[model samples]
Each structure stands twice: as structure tokens, then as C-alpha cells.
Target: MAIGYLGPEGTFTHAAARELRPGADLVALTTQAQAIALVEDGSIEGAVVPVDNTVNGVVLPTWDALLGTTASRIVADTLVPVTFNAYALTGDVVPEVVVSHPHALAQCARYVSSLGVPSRAASSTAEACASLAPGEVAIAAPVCAELYPVATIATKVEDGAGAITQFGVVSRDDVRPTTDRWTTVFAALPERNAPGSLAALLTPLASLGCNLENIVARPLRGSVDYVFLLFVTDLDQDREASALDSLRAQCSGLSVLGRLAAAKHSRPDGASGIPARLAPVRS
Candidate 1:
């Protein structure tokens, strides 16, 4: 099976794709949108796109793409624990400027600011690593040093060690219910100027005993309307069905992106325990 990922090769999304399906054919596209487009058009089985990062929050472009598409749904997800480093073509010279993807720059803001040099955005961290000049540094993964003719001048340059990025594998079909640890849903509330309208939409989830993991509101393009992305956990089969039925009645538009089992190895503590929602039931 062929899977697509945001690339020119050597991106974190590419790494996540490999992690999700080892030994599968991987197609690299220039942007997350392009990868998603391929999956939506049936050109590829699935595509891995970064949805959220610990340091920078949601990836806006990917969020927008998810909202804009109707044929695609998130089928699986993997968390990539990231720690960036500064790479340079030559270690001897002080870098006059730095380059990396916008997210990388944001992740290592403190380190980048400390260098007191201008920074430029590249399509990906790997591309930035490959494009560096003698006095230019790239904030990239340590693997970039091996992939390109770059030296790791600085290591662990991110603001914190617990920097994790969440990548979603989007496909044309919805994922079947598994050991449901997380359910990702997107909904468009009826456009009303009333202050309590958003809260009213969320009331059903609470009543159904669904625990919300995260919620993000994005303004629809060219309109005052908004769409909400929600991650809910600790929902059993009954609650899941109930929540969706209630949501459908309340929302102008609703999509159940995926019901997924959390990645075991993706946990920050490196433990292989099951997520709380998927814990063994007591007799």
C-alpha cells in the first residue's frame, strides 16, 4: 500500500508515516494539503499530516484542510516525540542566519533568538538542512546530520523536552471501532450571535459521560461562522453512539473523523501501558 506524507523527503510527517506502516511505499508531497488531496482523490490509500504540536498547538494549514475536505477522514494517528537541533554545513563558523520550517523555528524560539541572527522558513526541516551554506544553520532533526552533509552544532534546542507532535493518517474510509481510546470529531455549530451558543453545543457530551480531551475552534474562511474540532475520551459503545446522535441533532455539520486506539509507544514516559479509556474492564 502507498501512503503519502508532507515531504520533499525527511520530514517529521514522513517519519511518522514510516512508524505507522513500516516497509510500505511512501510518497512525498510538498505540502500537507497535497498529501491530503491525494488521499481524498483516491490516488493514495492514506496520508499522514501533522495536526497538532506540543509547542505550537494546532497546525493551522492541516486543520483547514481537514475542515475543507469531505471525502477524507482521519483513520489513525501517531505521536512523534520531537527534539530539534541546529545543523550547519561547517561547525567552525558562527551562523549568520538560520533556516527551518516555521514550526521548528517556533519550537526552538529561545535558541533561535539567542543566536541573534535572522531566520528564514524552509519547506521542511530536512530541506533546510540540505540547503544550508557555510554560515547558515538549520534547525532540524538529528537524523538530518546523517542524511545531509551537515553537522549537529547544537542539540535539544527546543523549549522543553516533552515536545510531541500529533500526526493523523487520513483516508477515504472511516476507521472501524477498535479499543476506542480517542474519538476525534468536527462540527459546525449554527451561526448565532448569542454568547452561550458554543456552550449549548457541548452540553450533550457532558450528559453522555464523554470526557473531552481537547477542543479547538477555527473560523470558517470568508465567513463569521466557525467549526470546532473535538477530541473526546472515556466513551464506551453506548456513550459513543449517544454522543454522536445528540451531536448530529445539534450541529449544522458533523463529522466523526476517527475512533482510534492511542499509540502505545508514543507516550512521553516511554511506557507501554494502555490508555486510560482502554484499560481492562473490572469484573
Candidate 2:
């Protein structure tokens, strides 16, 4: 099966893909949209993409893409720890521009500042490596330092190796969870953003005893609307319909983004075999 992931080999996303669903034929694609598009179009059997990171919060456009992808269902979830490197031609001139994804640049902001290197964004981390010219560095996984002759310095530059990003196993077919998991997505805005309206909006979940894990409140840029995300403990058959009702009533002004499955997650460690947990923050 061809599986899609945020790539060039050696990227943290690729690392997560290897750990979660190893030996699947890997599809190196550009944006998260592009990756999901492949699945929608039947170009790939499944795809893995980053949903969140500890230090940086959400991956932005990816959030929108996940909501927008057609008939895509996240079958599984896993965490991948990121370790970035300053990759250039071995013993060659230092690079002025480092081609990488915007998320990679933010994850390694301090490194970029230390090296005084500017960055470029690509569809995928792997695609960025493919586009790099000679003498330019790429702040990506050393495994991603392809195009032959590129070198990597300063491995694991992210401040939080403890930091982890969430990825979804996407396919149109329903794949039941193999273990405990949770599902999160934006529901709706029942009303325009107003004084204390959002909190007043979510009072129903508490009433239903539907323990919410996190709530993301974002104002749609240049609009009076808002997007509210509820990261609740995974629901089962008895609770699914009622939970959907609660979501609809609570955020009547909001549009219905699919209530996809999410699993409880933690950061992975080599010895303990459990990923460290971040303090309860809005996912």
C-alpha cells in the first residue's frame, strides 16, 4: 500500500510514519492538501500528516486542509519527535538560504537566528530537498538531505525533543481504533464573536459530562466568525449521537466540520515506551 507522509526521508513525519505503519510503500508529497488529495483521488492507499506539535501549537493550513479533505478518515494517530539539522554540501560553502517548510523554520527558529540563514517553503520537506541548489543549506532532517552531497550539522536542534506532533492515518475506509484514542475537530459558531460569547457557548458539553480535553478558539481573520475545536475523550456507540447533538446545539453559529476520530496521545521516549504528556492545553 502506498502511504503518504510529510517527507523527504528522515523528516520527523517520516520517522513517525515508520514507527506507526512501517513497510508501507511511501508516497512523498507536497502540502497536506496534496497528500490528502492523493488519497481522495485514489492515487495512494493512505497518508500520514502532522496535526500538531507541542511547542508551536497547530500546523495552521493543515488544520484547514484536514477539515476540507474529501471523505478522509483518520484511522490511527501517532507522535513523532522532531530533530532538525543544518544540511549543506559536505565541506562546501556555508549556505545563505535554507529551503524548508515554514513549520520547519518555526520549529528551528533559534537555529535560523544563530546561523543567520533565511528559509524557503515547499509542498513537502522532501520536495524542499529536491529543489535545493548547490551551496545552499536546508534546515530539515539529515535523512532528508538528499539531492546527493548535502551535509547536516547540529542534529536535534528543536528545544523540545520532548515536543511531539500528532499525525493521522487517513483513508476513506473505516478502520477501527486498535487502542485508546480521541477525536477533535471544529464544530461551529452559533453566534458571531461577542462579549464572553464563546464560553457562554460551550456550557452544554459540561452539562452532558462530555469531558472536553481542549478547546481551540480562533477568530477567522477579517471576519466576525470564530472556529471552536473540541478535543474530547473518544466517544463510543452509546455516546456518539448525543455528543454530536451537544456539538451542534453548543455552536449553532458554526459550520459542521466532520467529527473525526482522535485517540489519546503522548510523546514517545526510547526507554519508557510512552510519549511524555504536555500540560492540558487547547489542542
**Alpha-carbon RMSD to native, per candidate:** 6.8, 5.8
User: How does candidate 2 fare on TM-score?
Assistant: 0.76
Compared with the true structure, the alpha-carbon lDDT of candidate 2 equals 0.66
Against the hidden reference, what TM-scores do the models get?
Answer: 0.87, 0.76
Model 2 is weakest, by summed lDDT over 10 consecutive residues, at 255-264
The lDDT for every candidate, in the order shown, is 0.79, 0.66
For model 1, residues 47-131, the per-residue Cα lDDT tens digits are 8888877667778788677666787877777788898988888778687999999999998999999999999999999889877
Stretches of candidate 1 exceeding 4 Å from the true structure: 263-283
- The most accurate candidate by lDDT is 1
Error of 2 at 185 (Å): 2.9
What alpha-carbon RMSD in Å does predicted model 2 have with respect to the real structure? 5.8
List runs of model 2 lying over 4 Å from the truth.
Answer: 41-43, 145-147, 191-197, 217-223, 234-240, 251-283
Task: Tally clashes: model 2.
Answer: 18
